[model samples]
Target: MSRTGIATGPNALRGIVMMCLGMACLAINDAFAKYLTDVYSPVQILFLRNLIALPFAVIIAVRLGGWDAMRTRRPGLHLLRGTLWLAAATLFFTGLRYLGLAEATVLIFAAPVIITGISALFLGETVGWRRWSAVLVGLVGVIVVVRPGGDAFQAASLFPLATAFLYAILMISSRWVPAEESLWTTMVFQVLAAGALAGLASLWFWTPVALSDLWLFIGIALAGTLGMTLITEAFRFSEAAVVAPFDYTALIWATLLGYLIWNETPDAMTWLGAAIIIGSGIFIILREARPG
Candidate 1:
């Protein structure tokens, strides 16, 4: 019923499946990126990711509607979105350098909670006490995960925390963009700008990727592009509220992959914090889903 022609009717099963699969793909992509970080800078890794993804983005735009699909008088929105995304990815990847995969993922998963808090503080949106309490609980969850003064905590934890904040702002600003703008248009802008920006930053840190590691780069590109497309499809098939909750499935993927690949086993506190964050996020999602 919306301008984007997304079906938000009673049938949400498709959306749920797409959302879960999308999270899985993204988790796989992150695993690839994490593996590469040992030998490559985050900037270098992301610059190459954007470079590899650019062709796919262009092909998607062309297939969707050729040049017409990419037409947007308001280029600023797309530019800003892309820039924010680049910064977010950079910070997140850097965080992975020091944090375990599941730990880093749990922190970023607080984005929904951050979005709610940001709306109240900056957008002048009215948030009832119940929602406000949930937001507070979410922040507490973040603190528990960060454990700033604890032996287990690292300063790098702030990277993902900041990623969550930037991502929240990115999501909010995206609302200013008209629905008439094609998704591929936004994607192309993201790939181009992120690549260019990261490429510039990578000048000091760039390393030649060996042929043996070329497969990892390709894997990162494929999983990332696919994850982005599938998540988009998830939204198109169902209402935001319907599929949003399933985003937490990324944690499951991250935890399992972390154990199998990196031998990561999160402490009980990490799981506890993740549960609190996930619960608060679900509370916000459910509140938003009410019929109003």
Candidate 2:
């Protein structure tokens, strides 16, 4: 483990690489989900995606250890984390219906900044003035993109903002989970819990999916599960602060996919705001990495 006791080692390069690839996978998954939104409710999409991922999570769990690895002392925390995951996914997918891929992506990227504050408040972690200033700048960036009362504003914009908050809470909670709990087990619990919750919500909004769309559902599930696994491994190898900055790579992927697939382009203000948010987030990560 690293000197910081964050349950990661000192291999920052490997962590950064894994995080970049994982972000790519996640971006592709989001693109697929956005495309499928044309035909399915977000609830149905989430249920199917998790259902397909459950078996893969089980396989990884058993391979990592026996079924015993799945046993955890912190079941309640797992449940809470899973709920947050479900909520974040629901909000993001719903928001995608109204927001372009790049715009939605830049909005959610605000999570890291929100996480810094949440860590300070809820986890009682120390935050220096520099980091706090960075957080404020990041929030300003988000406001610039959201433009609360401007013509660019839409109620749907709030979905990604809320998603970012919930995602921050989920990340903070992960830090509290016992390090001994295998990554596979943590992943399994999260998928199962999210799937169960989504399944319940699906009953009210279920719609028949065409046979042609089955592959898209499977792709979403595989991409998301693999991305989660890679990011989990990334954290195991390096400090979260060291690896997290790479997540901004998703903006690049989102930009390319948005233009190629839908001809959607983010406005100048959106790009400006994204630049500010990303810059502030990177500063926070770098500051946290410094010796205190």
Candidates' C-alpha lDDT: 0.88, 0.90
Residue pairs that clash (backbone atoms under 3 angstroms), model 2? none
| Model number with the top TM-score | 1
Residues 72-188, candidate 2: write the lDDT tens digits: 889888888888999999999999999999999999989989999988887789998999999999999999999999987989999999999999888777888898888777889
User: Residue 217 CA error for candidate 1 (Å)?
Assistant: 1.0
Query: In model 2, where is the ten-residue run with the lowest total lDDT?
Result: 1-10
lDDT of 2 at 256: 92
Q: Which ranges of candidate 1 are over 4 A from the true structure?
A: 1-11
Lowest lDDT block of 10, candidate 1:
1-10
